[model samples]
Target: MSIQITTLDSGLRVASEFMPNIETVALGVWFDVGTRNELPKQNGIAHLLEHMLFKGTSRRTALQISEEIENVGGHTNAYTSRDLTAYYARVMHQDTELAIDLLADLIQNSTFDATELEREKQVIIQEINLSRDTPDDIIFDYMQMAAYGNQPLGMSILGKPEVIAKISGADLKKYAGIHYCAPKTVIAVAGRVDHAQLLDWVKKYFGQLSPVSDAPIPPSVYKPENILINKDSEQAHLSLALPACGGKDPDYYAYSIYATLLGGGSSSRLFQEVREKRGLAYTVSAFLSNVDDTGLLGIYVGTAPGEVAKLAEVLREQLVDSSRNIKKAELDRAKQQLKAGMLMALEQPFSRAENTAQHLLTFGRVLSVAELIEKIDNVTPADIHRIVGKMISAKPALAGIGPKKSMKVWEKFELT
Candidate 1:
């Protein structure tokens, strides 16, 4: 497989990986604008705009857009995150042109009709309600809010219900005009794609967009704070987070290994200690999310309400133990697991395409699979110890959803 990247005169970036053996193409556009880019009052505008883009464009109705793709046996979807909004389609290699044109039209020239805006407001409100109904979803939002307080990074991507209801078509268009510039967008394609043809299509579809004045980049703020939400539920949801490395941080690889050893799988410390040995919780895991300026090492577990205290105790013990001393064997295992997962994910065309685009956007270049494995393998036991020490020193922010009594119980067993 070979990857080619080009920047059009209009500033849109096109990156493609040719997979001649495959018959499908996964193509997408990524915008570096999401909830974090919104003004205080326009909190949910980014996500709302994402939804409206698919509703209709200057050339096609929502139903027409769906039907066109389905007729070609293609699939299309979109998502909004803390810092980006993405729209993607997977189709037969022969239909790449149609997919690109449809995506470009939806993102760049959406009408955002008044009626459509009102209709989408209800849809988003329902989405918010649905999120609240799911404990797993709500818990993460709460944990993020607790970690960053009221900063832009802390705000929910779904935005507040009241604010979402008031988002106007004008708001959507204005925000889109400002942040959805060619310079801040990328077109990524993989699987049975020709780089030259993809670049030609990108230029034809996206070159018309006029560049806008660059907006100031927002600083990602990470505050050490704890928040607990009292709810009537059978299982208590607990999340603990500490500020860590970003995508560009030098310790990025080390931190990934650290997270894997902490709670990545069933053999991980948190899982084995908190669940296997003590039977304190049924589900436990750890993950790392690296943004532009900052990152987070987050641990989450769902356990019986009565076992919240024991769960917290065991988690703290494991954390402190790891921070003080991580065995060389354990460190090697974590590195192997991290590298193995990276290699496995690269086999999928969609994953490869997305990985290439994200790496290019964030790091200015993509690291080859072999280079990534080498980096992971080079991490020493001392590297793991140093990362863990930094994490331990950075007081973690905790978020819990369950009975108020559990909060009181868990609070008594803070990380020492």
Candidate 2:
């Protein structure tokens, strides 16, 4: 439960939490660049670079990277998101140094070989086609596109097949060189480890890398007016989004409670009203996505083609009603659920490490578990109602994939 933070002379910020009873350590390097940092022509380069980094580095082949970690019984992987790309490894406490070196080499010295780039391009294109074939996956991307419009935040992390095909080794190298600097990266480790020893290892490995000038900020804010996409599928995939609060917003915790009450679980209002009582759909839920500058409150549902209209109508009614007359008992349950979820997540070391690094990256400091718990507990029914009032006043962007008839029926549920 004790955490330590340090800043290396090289500009890499290192944070660690000591868990004396644990036998494994989770370490990660988070780069503060993703789709939002890409220019129009380089939409998917950050994600592509994630794939390429694993392909090979100047010091080792891709298989060699895999073998080295597996030989130690360690696991390694990476992911790209709208705002960051992360490379992480979990290993026995004794293997922490080896893990650190391997991650450092992959990030700082990746070769981005031309042959490998061509092969990976085809791999990603196949991935894009695969996503298109899956209705549930395809609809969320469309929802993001509709919510953010033409902004970088709206662009797909996988990029278009045509665009991904054109991404060459040169593009990968240029983007990596510009965005992957010490100032834009955070190295985080948690579990059984010595904080001083971890700092020394980071200094030895990453200290020599220089910082980049003019680090890019994330894309400008742009909330869409309204948008819809038509696709052929068995059931209709529907998503509605309105811009909400980010991490720093005063209403951020209140919005989380609001979202939970709206559609968090089986007992949630969306499920109880839309599915359990009315039999409108098989699946329905809501989520709060809080980014650096802005956030989104989204509602998603999958239903029979003929029931899409009914589902949307019920969802709107629930939204409007919740804002108008949220019961005190329901509000109390939502707060307890959110607090319990947050407390449970803190029990895992990996979650703790990630929570530490992401808050540092976004807010420049981490809020303690006590602070977060208190914030959630303090959100009264009145607070939620006020936030809901603001949410209802804003226009929501919608996306759907299903029969042509369902696509046209959304006009009836349009936000005014």
Candidate 3:
């Protein structure tokens, strides 16, 4: 099901996608996050505030927040990303009002108790430690740093230990009061939803949320670099990144097709050549990270210490070869894989709700499945060649963690 939207006088957006046969509904409130919106002292404030919301509100305690939803056989959750922080719920259709009211209450009335802040702070610090210990997880953070260099887009959302320790309850309240305004908020629902009823509930609970004056964040400036960290490991972790277009760019679809043909799945070039054929690595894949004003297209591989050089050379060879020799059959397979992935995502209520919010925030409207499929269908071999040429024409940001000898292979131009 596709979505319909209505904007409130308070500036909050309410959207719904109705699936008649389903008894459950998924709904969420999205914020137009100031991704680069915080001051230098406020690096991880956006994510810190997310954890605080569930701790307590003026109307209910933290346990009550969990008990209320679970008692009703519904689940509530939240997540923070580079550009957005969302609070979501999945519930039986009849319980939609309760879900909406609880979510609105959490956003508007969260009290940020001091004791709760101290406790949650430790939890997050532990989280930061856990991320550091996971080599695969930490490598992407390094990759982003190499991609955007000193910009907010490059900073880890989990934040630095010192910064998280410094964030206070008052800090969370101040940030929320300004950035979590009605204008920055969106309420999206999918599955067995009644638009009029949903709108009425939203207006009653969210109508009073006031708008805040916000200044535009400076666009991220990309200054790609190469970073390598020496460590003791069984395998060398490699991440190769190059600049790419944002969500709205005309070439975004073509870029997606290009990446798919390059190594998006097991049957794609990187997987087949690097793993299935020569057995150089167990995990080799290409992916895209598209955000508001800019994006990165990267390929990651984990290979043996002795084979790291071969893997790096092969990766460069595939990029250069595929840009010139991509065939129609290869393009067709990538396009079919991409289209099927999108269409299959539409059936899940959570995914539908996410797409509704994401599209509304990005394009100011939701794109239908038919529209998306048509775009994927139109990408051809020539389009892949042209786009891949653009992707591989520049010096890429290389990030790696392993023995210094093996990781250094990525810093040389011999592969080209």
Question: Which digits, one per residue and each the tens of the lDDT, describe model 3 over residues 1-416?
Answer: 55789997777888998998899999999987844676657788888898899998989999999999998899999998888889999999989999999999899899999999999889988998999888788989889888887788888888888988999888898888888888777889999999999999998887557766475655886687888999888988889888888888877898888778788998899999999999999998888887867888888888898898788778889988987898788889999998889879987998899988888889888888888888888877788788778877777888989988887776773324
Model 3, runs deviating above 4 Å: 413-416
lDDT of 3: 0.85
Local accuracy of candidate 1 as per-residue lDDT tens digits, 242-348 = 88888788788888999999999888888788878888888899999768778899988998889987777787778888776888878888988987888789888
Candidate 3 residue 151 Cα shift, in angstroms, is 0.2
The true-versus-predicted C-alpha distance at residue 231 of model 3, in Å, is 0.4
Tell me the TM-score of model 3: 0.97
Over all chains combined, what TM-score does candidate 2 have? 0.97
Candidate 1 has a TM-score of 0.97
Model 1, residue 60: C-alpha shift (Å): 0.2
Cα-based lDDT for every prediction: 0.84, 0.85, 0.85
How close is each model in CA RMSD to the real structure?
1.4, 1.4, 1.4
How displaced is residue 244 in candidate 1, in Å? 0.8
Give the TM-scores of the predictions, in the order they appear. 0.97, 0.97, 0.97
Q: Residue-wise lDDT of candidate 2 within 1-416, one digit each (tens)?
A: 77898977667789999998899999999888888888778788888999999888888899999999999999999999988899999999999999999999898888988898999998998999999888788777787887887788888888888888888888888788788888778888889989999988998887545666466676556475445556666788888887788878889999999999999988899999999999988989999976787888888899988998788788778877777788888888888899889889988888888888898888888889888888888888788778887887777778887788997887457544
